[model samples]
Target: MSEIVLRNVCKEYEKGNFAVKDFSLDIHDQEFIIFVGPSGCGKSTTLRMIAGLEDISDGELWIDDQLCNYFDPKDRGLSMVFQNYALYPNMTVYGNLAFALKVRKASKSEIDEKVHKVARILEIEHLLDRKPAALSGGQKQRVAIGSAIIRRPKAFLMDEPLSNLDAKLRAQMRIELAKLHKELETTIIYVTHDQTEAMTLGTRIVVMKDGVVQQVETPIELYNHPVNLFVAGFIGSPSMNFFQAHVTEENGRMVVFIGNPKDGKKIYLEGRRSELARLRAMDQDVTLGIRPEDIHEYADAAELGIEKATVGMNVTVTAREMLGAEVFLYFDEQKKTHAVRLHPKNQTMTGEKIDLYFDPKKIHLFDQNTEESIFYREETV
Candidate 1:
C-alpha cells in the first residue's frame, strides 16, 4: 500500500518567501486525491515536491514509514504524467511504452506482454505502431499514460495532464482516467486548476491557495460544507454567490439584512444557525454564501416552504443564458454579478425584474473579518 504523509511541509524558494507553507496531509492508498486551486497557487509545486522533482525546503516527506525527502525522483516509485504528454516523438507508441522496462533490462517477451496489456487498458492497442506526432491529443495522452502504467509504479503523480485538450476531449479523458484509476487500483495525486475535474474524479480534494492548503474533504463534503470563504467561493462552477449582510436579533430571532436594510430585504436564520450567529456574531457584518441552485424562483420557493420575507429579493435580469437542460440568470447585486440556475423553461428576459428566494437551510455564513465559515464543523474539517 502506498501511504504518503506530509508533516508541516514548506517549500521555501527564498529565505522569507515560500511557495508552500506548513502543508500536511495523510494520503491513503488507492485514494484519488486532487490538488486544486487557481494559477500559481502551488498545487503543481506541491505535487512536484512529493515526486522529488523539487527540494522540500522544510518538514518531512514520508512514504510508507520511510523518510523520502532525499530520495531521487526515479527512486520514489511514482510515475508522473505531465501536461504535455511528454512522449518521445521519435518513438512509436510501442517503443514509448516499452522504454521504461528496457531501462531495467526486462526480458523482451515480458516487455511486449506489459506493453500490449497497458495498450489494451488505455485502448491504444490499435495505435501502437503510430508515432506521437501522428496521434490525436487524447491518443497521445493515452500513450503517455500507457508508458507510465507499464512501469507499475507505487502511485501516479499527474500535473494538469488534461489541461491541453479541448473541453469535449477533456470531458472524455476525465471519464477514461476515472476508469483507468479503478482498473489499476493505484493511488493518484492529481494537480489541476479545473474544479470540474477535481469534483468529478477525486476521492478527497485538497483546496490550496497562495501555497497554503485551505481544506481537505470528500467531494460532497467540500461542496456542502467549506471551512473558509476562499474554499466556498472556489469549489463550485459559476461559484458561490456572496452578499454583504448584517446579522442582528429581531423579535428574538436572528435575521440577516441583505445589502442596505432600507431596501426591506432580509433572511431569517433558525435553530443551530441562529444560535451560533447569536453567540459569536450578533450585530456583526457577515458574508452570506449561497449557490446558484440554492436560489429559487417564487413557485419553487413556495413549494419548498421558504418564508415570504426571504423571497422578497427583487432583481433586474441583466443577462439570461439558456444552457439546454438548465438556464442561468445573471443580475447585479452589491456591485457584483450573481447567478441563478433555473429550469430552462424560464421565460425571463434581459431587463425584466424578477423575485428570487434563497434556500435558508442551504445558506452559508462567513465572518466578515476572519472570512471563516460560521457553520464550519471542526470535526469534519
Candidate 2:
C-alpha cells in the first residue's frame, strides 16, 4: 500500500512568501488523485514536494508511515511523467523503456520481458523500434508512460502529461490513462490546470487557489455543492452564474431578489433550504449562484412549478451557440454576462428577448462579504 500523506506542508521561496501554504492531504493507495487549479496556484509545486524534486519548508511528508521529507527522489519510489516527452531522441522506444531497468543492472531477459509487456499495455509495440523523432505526439507520450511503467514504482506523479496534445488527441489519451490506472492499480497523483481533465480523470479532485487548498471532493460533489464562490466559478466550463441578491422573508417564505427589489426578478426558497438561508442570511445581502443548466425556459419552468417565481426575468440574448447536442444562450444582466443551456430547439436568436427561470432547489446562496456558501454542509468537506 502506497498511502502518502502531507501534514501542513509548505514551500517557501523567499522570506514570508510561500509557493505552497499549509497544504495537507491523505492520498489513498490506488486512488487517482488530481491537483487542479489555475497557473501559479502552487499545484505543481505541491506535486514536486511530494516527488522530492522540491524541498518542503515546513510540516511532515509521510509515505507508508515513513517520514520522507529528506529522502532522495529516486529512493522515494515514485515515477514522474512530465508534460514534455522526456525520451531520448537517440534511443528507440524499446531502449528508452529498458533504460531504467538497465540502470539498476537488471538482466537482459528481464528487461526485454518488462519492456514488451508495458509496450503492449500502452499500445506502442509497433513503435518500439522507432526513435522519438520518428513517432507522433501521442506515440511519444505512450513511450514515456511505458518507460515509467517498466520501473513498477510505488506511485506515478504526472505533471500535465497531455497538455501538449490537441483536443481530439487529449480526449483519446484521457480514456487511455483511465484504463491504465485500473490495470496498474497503483497510486497516481496528477497535476493539471484543465478542469475537464480533473473532472473526468480524478476519483477525488483538489481545488487550489493562490497556494491554498479550497476543497477536495469527487467531481459530482464539487460540481453540485461547491464550498465557496471561487470553486463554483472555477470548476465548470462556462462556470456558474452569480448575481447580486438580497434575502428577505416574504409571506412566511424566504425570498431572494436577483437585483433591485422593484424589478420582480426574484426566487423563492422552500423547506430546508429556506430555513437554512433564512437562518444565515435573512434581511442580508447575498450572491445568487446558479448553473446554466439549472436556468430553464418557459415550458420547463411550468413543468417544475416555478413559473410564478420567474415572472419578470426578461433578458435579451446577446449571443447564441448552437452546439448540436445542446443550445447555449448568453445575455447581459446587471453589467455581467450570464449563460443558460437550453434544448437544441431553443429558437432564441441573438438580439431576441427571452424569459428564463431558475429552479428554486438548484439555487446557491453565498455570503456577500465572505463569499462562502451559506448552504454548504460541513460534513462534505
* Candidate 2 Cα misplacement greater than 4 A, ranges: 378-381
What lDDT tens digits, residue by residue, belong to model 1 across residues 1-381?
A: 899999999998889998999999999999999999888889878999999999999999999899999999999999999998888889999999999999999999999899999998988899989989899998998898889988899999999999999999999999999999999999999998788899999999999999999999999999999999999999999999999988898898788888877877888887787887887789999999999999999998999899564846889999999989999999999999999999998899999999999988788989988999988884343
* Candidate 1 lDDT trough over 10 residues, lowest sum: 372-381
lDDT of each: 0.92, 0.92
Q: If scored against the real structure, what TM-score would every candidate get?
A: 0.98, 0.98
lDDT of 2 by residue, 1-381 (tens): 799999999999898998899999999999899998888999889999999999999999999999999999999999999999799889999999999999999999999999999999999888888989998898889999989988999999999999999989999999999999999999999998787889999999999999999999999999999999999999998889999999998888789999889887889888788888888999999999999999999998998888876554889999999999999999999899999999999998999998899988888999988999998994344
